[model samples]
Target: MTDSTKPTVLIVGGGIGGVALGMLLHKAGVPFEIYERATTVKPLGTAMNFNATTAVMMKQCGVYDEFMAVAKPFSAVQVGNTHRTIDYKIDFSEQEELFGAKGFIISRPDIYDLLVRQVPKEHFHLGKKVISSEQTNEGVILRFSDGTTAEGHILVGADGAYSSIRQHMYDQLKKEGRLPATDGEPLPFSSLCLVGQTKSLDPSVFPSLALDESQVMTVLIKDTPYACSIFTTKKNTVAWAVGEILDENRSKEGEKNEEWGPGAAEAMCQLSRDFPVISGGEKPLTMGDLIDWTDKDYITKVMLEEKVFETWYDGRIVLLGDACHKINPAGGAGATNAVHDAVTIANWIHALPPNPTKQEIESYFEEYKKERLPKAKEAYDSSRMFKSISSKSYLGWIAAVCFKHMPSWMNRTLLSSMMAYRPTVSFLPDAEDKGTVKPAHQHSLETRRILKERQEAATTAAVKA
Candidate 1:
């Protein structure tokens, strides 16, 4: 029972997903508002990458040129053990071969900044914590903790792993006996993530890093408490993250784990004692150096959690990003997948019929869930498998050997297949991308990568012919 004349969208959370979706909706000439719980938008979180799929979406959304300046696009990645031994290297260094496109390794906050800048400041409501939501025949009404209320045609939750909107949605379902089991505490935190950035370091300490203008390295520790380290550097500074397997410890007071506040920065640093990155130099480089270089304010320590839910929508309310599927940061796929969800949902909304009914909105929700649910699960599984392989155990041993012994060309080919790029929305035009240098072999890789699949009817017609 939405307004026949005006269609409005209310988006919760101002993270990558919400902001990205807002950008798309705005471009599509739809009216929308973004509510962010935080009073201020800050660039935080570990360094993340924008794979080809992400780049394609950004291009479709028309924001490629704006990011090339701040983003560092690299043609190679080096993965190995804690000792700095090279295992499987993805060297698309020769711009001739099509690795599709180099990934943009930018920090999380930077991405937020990029997205927020595009949207009008008036549309973004800061410090608006959505305490509850009510859906009626006309529209959905949102109540903020500040005792304010706002109504919109539909509510989209992009809040994060611990979503207040999701809780409200689940509460409604449980009250109706529709949800049998409680959503429960997040799929037990698989590991704890300790992330921070270092100040400028001299070239002499790590020559390869210095040579490449940026260094990307990962260390695998495969014992009982499995762990992995991701270290990336640009110019004088290095951004690093280390993952430690969390012991299954739950107290009588519910589930007990690491708390991310107060002295968290200090405690997270202490966990990196033996986790060293052995360089080609005589002395080994430890997390201690990076920890000391980074200010306590920049440290991010949290238990990494991942899950893909069975339920996505309840009536006029729908979920996106971490609200729908929480993923480990191992593959840098978390935010990328969230961006994908935003674009996919936005396109569906952009094409809605005039004065759409509640049933019409629910159909779009079903379509979104049908398409993105599987994508979320696929990305989640891939992230977990990669996270596990970053170990020193027998499985890790096999992975390391396969990576080290695997032919480089074959590795590159497998890398292409594993990326599993999703199609972009058909409505948006191609973004102006002057900065991306097309590789020579792009004829086989890049060109083939971007083409949309033929419609089912078209394929059927071809088969009959």
Candidate 2:
């Protein structure tokens, strides 16, 4: 392409990450187009939590204020045993004082809408699934399942988990004898999730809900399944997701087929039986009583992990969001992390010297991988550990017991760490000194020392073992 011709960036999957990246690129005056396999965007999934980091990025992209207006913030998170409230609670007031911003809870579609509104309709081509793409010294060529073809300066595999682009890239490498094949492990925890909307909550009941409008409330039960319910918008509508740990082997191979389908409603009913909010369980819980057995299967296939890929980029093609790292909905990091990936990548691209060379583009991706890989792995491991701690087994019970008695300060510290986490990116200039706002407070020297000591201790323990 000539210098007069704007270099096109092809983005696959029009989800939150894809759209957010597109909007950022558009604002930076970069040429790009997004192709979504779906014919139209729908508010399909449940609720998500947005940490201060994600909220700040959204604000920079011009949707933070409007998005905040629609979401409700939970000022405190509660954990309980049977009917007794545990002392463990995340104090949002303290977090706000530390981070200088508040978190948000919003519907998946609300974020999608915010991103779509910023992009030109003509730039988006729906129903076009990417089949494969190849890169050359000049640019990249992409083929769609619809039999159309497009050429661009770069291709992004933001297609999400089960991404055809990722699969194709793997296939290409395998054909050239580059990678090894092995059985993929199922997630240690899997659950049947039921999600739907309900009427707005009474303010008198949930006084601690933070979202000005959309608030997510997660309640970790002592002996029963984990249940969470939250409002997604200012409208009186709420969405809830209930997870029950199942036999991983039985659940994956469909051995427990009878347990699914209609069993979803039964699952919620079981929640009421095991832990009744009226009897001191989490409050404002009505799904068990209001939902009908025939409530049309809203449950989706269980996920092993929020993310499926270990690496997110290859040559000129790259993956982001759900395509790269899928997080469990429990911690509300899924959507937030995805948006962070978009902003991070956009910033990396912006920081590139003017008219970067092909080797520089490749080097940029290398730096991206180095910076994001550890953070992605840490987030993934944290989610898995949290899920295991909330399961319905003997060990899970023991964990709950231990958690219940743990110091409230310890719990608060951990919760804050999860919310305030910022992935270490090697390429970006010092974000703070550069005048770019950060989501959390700067890491203290004491905290850094503690982290280093912990890393050393763990390394030594592993070596000894």
Candidate 3:
């Protein structure tokens, strides 16, 4: 258990970023607590994709073994027209080789569960909704919807896109007239996505489809607002989807949003039953199979949103993940980037001295922003580009040819160059250790001492063995 007297971090949101940050702080011997709005951390989403960069970080965190055991690792992505007129595939084997890691596709809840279990129950507070925050020279205080308050040495907003912490931070900045020109813009949406995972289907049903192989296949309808991406796992199931941006999918403006729960799951199933996702081999696999196999509770519908905020921090409060930069799911950076932020931000916090002054805290946050903002922009740009290139435009056509129709060897060289640039966790043993941006006088001496002792113990045990 964390000592109450120790310097503590209050992490808002209980998703991937919040839990991962708690886990890392625990490793650094830092006291921290996670506050989440959800009463229970159930499997919340359908499917998730992984690339080499994220894979390496997961391995470093010691969750790779378990993640791999449950996920389907894919080495390529296949894009084709729904009519089977044009079929193309991009092989990622060489890219995986370059990054020293393979890619994976897994159920979102399965991965979420794995991350949650690593953080102790004592560190988390479920059913707690953070509404606002106030900070002074000493530390920060959080105000919850239930009229309760939480005081901590630092406040990190790992909340999602509709982050209350972010809104509070922005409000404070504007009140100070530091951001008189900024706009809290809403995300623009061009497409709607319906996602769900079905019970394991027989690979024999779709000839040429190999079970247990790692790969992504996408079906696009030309000249129409329709597309579906499927990730097949050896676990006897497929995560599939059919998406469109029709008016029927959009919510009326100025209306409060209530979650479209599992009751809407059946609606998606009905719409997808006859929609074909892949027309390969003698028999085409239609969305009907997926809808029929998946439970009503597993389907989800959402308007895909992508954006990056210009400001990320103010005083003792800072932002991470979707709170600051929301990304399209095309590149699968959504969850990976969130976890990466947790580690990077934890590193900066780990460098902070006990009872740090306001100036010291602000400076460290500035340093954190310097390292992260560019990476967030890159993800935002890439995800936006991916969304566009998945369409029927000339650029999309060129991408399909260059990515899928190209030779296998050429494909590896082309994709790996892009894959290798992805951002990863910064605190792993093999990770690049750029020590705190703060001066040596403000360094985390206790953290350094503990880290040294751990290193020495490992050496001693090895020598004794």
Candidate 4:
């Protein structure tokens, strides 16, 4: 049963981030309903890498063990050229020893399914395309395309890059001249990506499929506009992607924007099919082989864009995940960052006062943004840096060389900064800090402790009276 004192949360969009937040809120005993525009969930995209940044929260939610089952361990990435010559390797083997958590790679849909099961079926509503949203002193309301309405105390826009909720919020803010000029601008994308996963292959055919650790092999052809890569999965399948780095102006002017769907990927797949891959097999492979092995219905093409919004919350409506920040996937941190946002947002909501006032709710939102904004920017910067290094330009070459030969101390410092921010739900027994490097300060955890102490003291005095 829900405590009437706690605010009921309405989350828009049923992506991984939204579902993740729903799971946390459920575990914390808070009421939340997730609304997705699509009637059925079609798990798209390739795969994602999750490390200490989110493993602690998964454990707190009691899903870490299942997550481990669905995911393959990730240790290092082998980068090379189309000629099959090794360039450099990005090592992650030290992550576990330094951060006290192992990194894993899992198919996007597999993890989504795991998280979705944690929430009750009734709480996750589908076919609810939210057209617009409005909030008042009493609560917030969402009007769907089908003319139905739902009300809740808090509204969270977890929609993707082209978020309708964000457009509506900006529309209102723009009319009042409160929205930043940058926020009103359209999202710009430069790179086009084709992502898909092959069916489970024979271990004899692909030797790497038998390994415990997911082997990531990437090939960057010199002076070419494309980068192709493949990853081994725990299920004996291989996930692959081909990214075409386009000139920003050229892409915006000449190319038709590619939407993320099945048929949309065919064109890009054809263009990159001939690109070479360094799969650890008896013979060399090409992107075409993997493309042919993958089911056409599961492939998707999308335009990669990066942006961090200035306004995350106004009134009772707040935004999380891709709705607020869209980062390139080149750094493999986009999903991790989204998961981090969900964790922080859930923490704040869980710590809220019973029947929180509008001012109090907004204050919590403010704190959530304050804690996540810098981290989002850091991820954004790291993504762009990685994207640049993966490109075929002269600058990309220089960046890659520098990274390959970076001093050990410098490399450790950089890795530490990115890996030291593990946060758990404040409502649960926090995950033990086992890393040699202590985690960064968490505002929500500190706030929850103080609030708990105050409530206990008040209860003692009332009992004595």
Overall local distance difference test of candidate 1: 0.70
Please give the lDDT score at residue 229 for candidate 2: 44
Order by lDDT, highest first: 4, 3, 1, 2
The candidate scoring highest on TM-score is 4
Q: In model 1, how large is the Cα lDDT of residue 228?
A: 42
- The sequence of per-residue lDDT tens digits that candidate 2 reaches over residues 366-394 is 66666566667667776766565557567
Report backbone clashes per prediction.
Answer: 3, 14, 5, 0
In model 1, the clashing pairs are 43-109, 200-236, 222-392
TM, every model? 0.84, 0.77, 0.84, 0.96
Q: Which number leads on lDDT?
A: 4
User: How large an RMSD does model 2 have?
Assistant: 9.9
Please give the CA lDDT of all the candidate structures: 0.70, 0.60, 0.71, 0.85
For residues 1-465, could you state the per-residue lDDT of candidate 1 as single tens digits?
A: 134554689999999999998998878778899999999765457677776667766767667767766666666557766556766764545322343445667766667788888798899999999888988867899999999999988889999988888889888888887864636444656677788766656757654555543456676653435354544544345678877655446322123544555786677678775677644466777777777877777777776777787778877788999997999887668988898888778866765665656777788778778777877887887677666566445765676667667776776665554454534654577543332333212111221222233245457889999
Question: Mind giving the per-residue lDDT tens digits that candidate 4 earns over 1-465?
Answer: 239798999999889889989988888888899999999888677888888788888887778889998899988777888788778877777788778788898988898999889989999999999988998998999999999999999999999988888888899999999999999877777688889999989977778888889988778867678888777888888898888777967566423543444456776777787888776665877888898899988888777777999999987888988899999988888888888888888888887887888998899999999999999999998888778866877878887887788777777687788888887688888776578888888777766776778689879999999
- Screening candidate 4 with a backbone cut-off below 3 angstroms (N, C-alpha, C), the clashing residue pairs are none
In angstroms, give how far residue 170 of model 4 lies from its true place: 1.1
171-240 per-residue lDDT for model 3 (tens digits): 8777877763544666555566788887766667654346457547777866666777777765756777
